[model samples]
Target: MANYRLVSFKTCPWVQRAAIVLREKKIPFEFQHIEPDNRPDWFRAISPHNKVPVLRIDDRISLFESASIAEYLDETHAPRLHPEDPVERAINRAWIEYMPTFVDLTSGHAYVDSEAEFEKAVAAVPGAFAKLETAIEARKGGPFFNGARYSLVDAAYAPFLQRHLFLERIRKIGQIDRFPRVKAWAVALSERPSTHSFPPAEFEAMYRASVKKRNKWISQFVTEKAAAE
Candidate 1:
């Protein structure tokens, strides 16, 4: 058995995708909490890009973009997360690539900019949701992305699916109900023991608090600028 450690942050979709793969594979590993802004020096040493979701497999350190990580884990682990068939695996990989584009269009990279930017992002949701609706319907036989069993594609996407559901609660984006297949898939994925195992409430609370603080700072900045004028 290889000694394993995963350096990650809760709110990062990339990190969450990797975590989902690890869980599905039933791989035993240590989770090291690293905040995005305050990443530890050791993490920087291991990952030249200073990204979260860096995995240490004994002495070999691996830094992967989420899709690559899922594929690598699926290939290495006991309970496989990918199909053995070449054509099926290609289809799975295609969906995995498709997810990031949907996530980008729907969630708008987590509204990381001005309110004007956020509004523009929110406006893009409907079209993005439409694409997802089509994709989900295409895979309607699925409890997982590839049909019966969960695959690397599902693991790669689970985090974004969760965020899309959560965003519906916080923002008036497109309704998940409009995408019935996706809605069911997200609910089922969320209920998985591994999916539920992470500390969502705690992370959400922290994120909400951070948003409030940032909003307050912006407000104060505006007031100060007006006063100066």
Candidate 2:
């Protein structure tokens, strides 16, 4: 087995996806948290894009971008996470590709300056998730995106769902409830042991700190008591 090191920012969603994939595959890896603002020369040397979620394989090869890192992990590890059927796998890949857009759509609420703008952003959320709901409804079984079996699609979206849950706690957008399938899928992903690859205390602390630092409309919703959880 190659020595894997995941270079990431503690609160990065993209980084979370790669971390989740590693945990799901039961792969042991070293987690290296780097400050995006003060990246070291070594990280810059390995990351052409200067992005988080760089998987340094055996300190020889480096893979940047969450999707590519995930694909590599699935292709190399046992118990492949993607579907066997080529068409089905392609379909899943399409949905996986859509996650970044979905995340952007839902993330707008935090940056908006006013409640009205926040509401508009929140209203736009369901439309993005509705598309996902249709895709999930088309699939066969329970909880996961691909019915009974867990796939890379689930891993791709898990970070978004985890953050969505936190967003809801920060302020109830209620958009998630509008799509039953998406809501259920988020719940199911939350229950997966691999869903939280980062330490809860550390993740929550950094997440809340990031929100507060933004000092935007949503920051008002987060309270000092947030840590009590």
Candidate 3:
């Protein structure tokens, strides 16, 4: 067995995606957390993108990009997470790439300060999810993006959905509620053991802290929750 080390940031969703795939494959690996703002020279040397979720194999070769890391793991390990059919696999890969569009819309919760801006941010979310809703509806299946089976696309979106749930707790975004199928897909992904790949309490604390640090409109809700605890 090859020794594996995953380079990560505590609150990074992308890093969590790689961790989810690792855990799903039952791969034993070491997790190394680093400060994203002050990266070490060694990390910089290995990561051309200077991003977290760098997977190092046997302390020699390093792979960057969460999607690439997840694909590599799925390819090398047993019980493939991707579709066997070439066309289906290609389609799945395309949806995985589409995740950033959805993620970017939800991420506005932590950045927008004014009520007007936040409202605008919230309004834009449904439009983004509508595309996903259409895709889910087209699938004409239940629970996951690819009907009954969970695929790399599910892994790709799990982090974003997890974070969205956290944000919803702070304030009811409810954008996801409009798309029932998409909402069900999110729930199915959440129930999977891999979706909880990171320590939930730890992730919640770190995520809340990051949002608090932003001191935006949403931060007030997070602050209130902290005081209540």
| Pick by TM-score: 1 or 2, better one | 2
lDDT of 2 by residue, 1-229 (tens): 9999999898888998998899989999999999978999999999998889899988899999999999999999988999999999999899888888998897789889898999888878988988988888877646899898898999999888877877787787788888888988988887788988656556666687788889999998886545321
Which of the numbered candidates is closest to the native, going by highest TM-score? 2
Which regions in candidate 1 have their CA more than 4 angstroms from the true location?
A: 109-119, 210-229
Q: Rate the local accuracy (lDDT) of all candidates.
A: 0.68, 0.86, 0.84
Report residue 132 deviation for candidate 3 (angstroms).
1.1
> Residue 73 of candidate 3: its Cα lDDT?
96
1-229 per-residue lDDT for model 3 (tens digits):
8899999987889988998888878899988999978999999999998988899999999999998999999999977999999998899899898889878886775688799999988888888889989988887756888898878888899888877877877778788888898888877877788887556666667788888888999888884343321
> Model 1 clash pairs?
none
lDDT of 1 at 31: 80
- Candidate 3, number of clashes: 0
Ranking by TM-score: 2, 3, 1
Write out the backbone clash pairs for model 2. none
Candidate order by decreasing lDDT: 2, 3, 1
